[model samples]
Target: MRAAGFAPTTATYNVLIKAHCSDAAVPIDDAVRLFQNIAKPDVCSYNTVIDGLCRRGRLPEACDLFAEMIANGIAPTVVTYTTVIHWLAREACFDDALKLFDEMSGRGIMPNVVTYSSLIDGLCKGGRAASALELLDRMVRERKLPNTITYSSVIDGLCKEGRLGQAMEILDRMRLQGRKPDAGLFGKLITGLCDSGRALEAANYLDEMILAGIEPNRLTWSLHSKINDAVVKTLCAKGEVSRAFQVYQSMRTRGISTEPKTFHLLVECLSKKNYLEKAAHVVRDMLSERCIPERETWDTIVRAYWSKKKVRQEAEEMWSQLTVTN
Candidate 1:
């Protein structure tokens, strides 16, 4: 419009304002300049600049602009107030955020779900989980349905804080309310459960994930491998060598391929059980399969035979074979 050498009317300017405000890469200063460049500013133009600044967490700048707009006889709209309030919440300036909310309500600008969710996210991040819970209740009381984004934010926060039980409750509530959890949300839950030593429950979710057509990625399998390896090693250290070998065999039969670290762990477990010959065989197979042994692998092999004087020559020959491939 400006390129056409035609002055934009207030509505046209408002359209430009909205366009510039939502563009993340466009700096607030550029938006302000565009508004100023207009021959006459309208409420929409002012609102757009204010919203852009507030959303970017420039509260003082937004407030200053709001004051200027009022002075210039441009009345603030509901969208204007909400944008500033959301910005305040993002900055964890809850007091200012709430104050603005009250002011907006007094001025007949009714708050909505966007307002509540902003504050809820802030509260959760501030470690005020109880306050966030209360805000969720308030949203319901205000007849605002919590959207998937709102619920997901709370769930993510809970998981990060290790509040898995509470997170699960929220997850159940979300499902009951007909909100399907996305893959990222489900993945977080699985990771949290596994980390908390609830692998049995994690296993159930794996099936649920498959049934829901959520493909498990490499990360999922990586976590599973770690948990299984830890359990197997624990069993082995407690003198359950047979059980440890069973675990290894199960991994092989299930096509759950492991890194060389798994083979190293197995070899260590076998050596501990006085199965040096079996351990040597495991090491040779690992090398024959072209799995690069770590420095620790060679150290383990050498040390396993060091205490027995009779097998020193055999250990040296095995070491030579291991180094040739490297």
Candidate 2:
């Protein structure tokens, strides 16, 4: 349009600034150039340039522009406050963020979900989960519903502080508000329990996760593997082969792959205890999962088959083929 001899409006500059800030190839300085060229730049122009500066991690420049906006007597909108507040919170400047929050409120820029979410996350990260929760209450009273990310940040803070029960309570409240807990919430809780050496409790949450149709990601699956591996090792060490097999079957039903050593331990223990039938089943499960047992594991199964049950010819042929392949 400018090339066509049409003078650009403030809205045009806003759009250009937004595009420059969002596109990596276009430097934010271009937006500032356009803003400077504007005969009468508007608040949107300033907001956009400030946002671009923030995105570029030039917060001092952004703050200077913000102060200029105030000096020019342009009322900052919620978007203006939110953009700066979120950036400040993210940079761990909770005190500055709080002051801005209060200042925005004083200006009657009633806080919205994004505004409170940033403040809540900032406070939580600053080891102020209690204050964060209190702010959550204030948010509720204002009829501004907190979203999943908001709840997850607080839950993560609670977990980090080892307040699992309080975290669960908050989760309950979030659910009651008709918001579904996503993977972040479950991951933090389960990870916390596992880190606390409460694998059994982690296992319980794993079950809840399955029931809730929350598919575990690679990290969550790896955590479950550790928990199940721990359970299997403990059971096998106590000579509870039946219980160990039960635990392994549970893992199998869920298609959870644990450490190969855990499977080897179970197979070796079962074979040595003369539970050749169960040991044979274990070997089959491992093969189906494409997890090849170690040589000692195979040898134990081979001995158990020959000594305890000479009638099992399939085991003999399988072990012979395995040996040839090895």
Candidate 3:
């Protein structure tokens, strides 16, 4: 274009420099050379080369270019600071990142959500969750709301540190502010609870989670099933068959499918305890869900119902429906 008498504008030059920085075949040195040859290289020129150098793990060189940019009176933007902060965080160089963030702020570059997010995430990953929480408070004071990743990182750190009560508080606070919990968040809470031997608390949250209209993913569903089964087995073994039946019914209504063995054990226990109709309902529910009870399960249910003369016809009808459905 220059040979054709069309001089490249500064914007055109910036574009060319960015193109060179992005091309792996063209080393960042080429882009730097091009930047130096330009009559005036703007902040974008500095940012492009710094980012390219950071991508290739040339942080020392990138910092040198940053210094040169500052010495040349080209002030760095939030993007400039964020790129370096994020890279430094990922590389486990938190002290330098923090100093750079402070310097950027001193230069009147207000950190954006991306900047705070990087700092918070990096702090949490560096085992400074308390500091991350402090930063989150500062973010709120600055009227900069933390997003999901921000909250999840802190919650995860709390859980890993076994500060579950505090974690639950944060979870509730997020809910009060209308940031609905996702399946991943609930899964983390549930796993943490189970690990702490507070599975019954996990069960309560599972119920609340489904009621809140969040569908559990595959892993969450599996954990939920395990917790519910534990509850049912505990109730049955304690001779609280009525309560156990109620839990069983709740599981069915929630579309939580348990194994045939769970139903069989519950029905057999209920029959021995003279809860004939509840036993019949359990068998009926099993057949409806295509979880066919074994022959012995059927025999116990039928014999228990036959012993109750008045409820015999209803039991026989339920049995007939079960057979036809199966």
Candidate 2 local lDDT, 1-326, one digit each (tens): 87999998888878887888888788888888988888777888888898889988998899889988999899899999999998888888888888998999999999899989988998888788897888899999999999999999999888888888888789889889999876567768777765665555655665676678876567677766665676677667667767777778888887878677887898899988888888888888889879988888988888777775555676788889999999
lDDT of each: 0.73, 0.82, 0.82
Model 2: residues with Cα > 4 Å off, grouped in runs = 1-7, 125-127, 216-251, 261-283, 295-326
Error of 3 at 58 (Å): 3.2
RMSD of each predicted structure: 7.3, 6.4, 7.6
* Candidate 1 CA-lDDT value: 0.73
Candidate 3 regions with alpha-carbon error over 4 angstroms: 20-33, 216-326
**TM-scores of all predicted structures:** 0.64, 0.76, 0.67
- lDDT for residue 143 in candidate 1, whole number 0-100: 74
Q: Which candidate leads the pack in TM-score?
A: 2
Backbone clash pairs for candidate 2 read none
Ranking by TM-score: 2, 3, 1
For every model shown, the clashing-pair count is 0, 0, 0
> Highest lDDT: which candidate?
2
Query: What tens digits encode model 3's per-residue C-alpha lDDT throughout 1-326?
Result: 98999977768878988898788988778887877787888888889889989988898888898898889898889998998898887787888888988888898899988899998888878877787788788888888888888888888878888889988998988887778877677767766775776646666776777788875456678766765676676667667777677778888777787877888999999999988888888888888888888999999988887788777878789999999999
Model 2 C-alpha lDDT versus the unseen true structure: 0.82
